[model samples]
Target: MGPYSGSKSYSGGEIMGLKVFFSVLAVSVAISGCAKSPPPAPNHLIMLTETADGQADASFMEVDTLEECESRASAAKKVFPMAKIKYIRHYCTHTNIKFEPFLHNPEPEGPSYVFGLNFVKDGKVLSKVSNFKSMTDCENKGKQVCVISYQNIVPGE
Candidate 1:
């Protein structure tokens, strides 16, 4: 038959080959559609701070890696080329640490010991403040992740 003619019929073997090709194509498409992405890689949090005497008027930055944190800390040291710096602290911790509350709020408001809930949900770090009678009470709140901090609001001069 001439190419592009409308008078063509498939033999039994030819039909079987076409069926096999379509079946393989359908399976590959289905598998690709249902494939899931790998989970996010674990990360570290670097807390870099510069302060005078390690206690007054501190400035801080949070970064994802230790090298970046150290780089920033080094740059901060050069901020005062002539003046002296009393303290510069850089801390690197895993993202899953229970001390997230303290990292977020260095100074929390409380005269009494309090329990803090710091958890990550939907790529956001959220904090829930509540007063629990004891550590046991806080842990019994049924949350998978928790952070406890004792805060005392200091009076400013």
Candidate 2:
């Protein structure tokens, strides 16, 4: 039984009980009042390329920046060590900034931009691409570093 059992009168014990109940209620309301934030968006860009070796088209384009593209291209060169870049082209930017689609390969911890935008500092708009193919006589320009050959690979294999 409570200390104020059967008592119609307001006692110090009853006041203490009320204080405890109200404090708990206040704490609960405070804890549950917040709203969670929404997730960020993704950035994807697509392109098509044709070269002397072959032609490649994709609805889902590659994800990378100009520098990253260059780096990967260089790695691709290691396959053909003597390869060098004769001349490179920027192709296209796809012209849509807000366009993005779900990644077909895998998901990441958070949203990452597929294309990075940059401004020209030395009178040249730096070239970047998700699709690229080195043209014929590519070596005439300098060396053949990167060239995509699609004639040999199977689809979605």
Candidate 3:
């Protein structure tokens, strides 16, 4: 009977309310879509050391970043404090890779060089390559846009 009572129409206030509801919903969805996912779980670094008698020992510790692993590796002596250590190697790889293989042949085959290559993009090492005949060979083998640097692995003092 009234102007809008019988008509299937919405009032200006009702339409505005609907618009506001939809706008809020749209904003919420957009914000959620743009939200970043939680960071990945930290990876573990395997600190392996070989003694003079050809005994290999490894200790696993969770490292939040690769830089921490490098720092720990640099201070291998203080960390392990073992005498007559032939070599101490720090390797950080994906969890899927089995570390048992590393412990088997801890010693290098011949007179070779061990180089540390840290990938720049992810600030993590993809793999460890040792037994390079020369520094030039190591550098050449690690030629990649993402490679940050290749440092000779010096036994921690």
Number of the predicted model whose lDDT against the real structure is largest: 3
Model 2 CA deviation exceeding 4 Å by range = 1-7, 35-157
Residues 1-157, candidate 1, lDDT per residue (tens digit)? Answer: 6777896799999999999999999999999998975433334332323333232222323466657656766765676455554443433333333332333343434443434334344323323345567556767886633333343222230
Per-residue lDDT tens digits of candidate 3, residues 1-157? 6767877788999999999999999999999999976434436565656635443434445566767766766776564555446445656543422222222233444332244343322524334434445445556766531111122233431
lDDT of each: 0.46, 0.36, 0.49
Candidate closer to the true structure by TM-score (higher is better), 1 or 3: 3
TM-score ranking, best first = 3, 1, 2
lDDT of 2 by residue, 1-157 (tens): 9987996877899899999999999988887785443322212232223333343322223344545544544554454324322223333222223333433332223432222223132212323323223333332333222334222222232
Q: Which candidate is the best by TM-score?
A: 3
Q: List clashing residue pairs in candidate 3.
A: none
Off by over 4 Å in 1: 1-6, 38-107, 110-143, 147-157
Q: Estimate each model's TM-score.
A: 0.34, 0.23, 0.37
User: Candidate 3 local accuracy as lDDT?
Assistant: 0.49
lDDT of 1: 0.46
lDDT of 2: 0.36
Supply candidate 2's per-residue lDDT for 11: 88
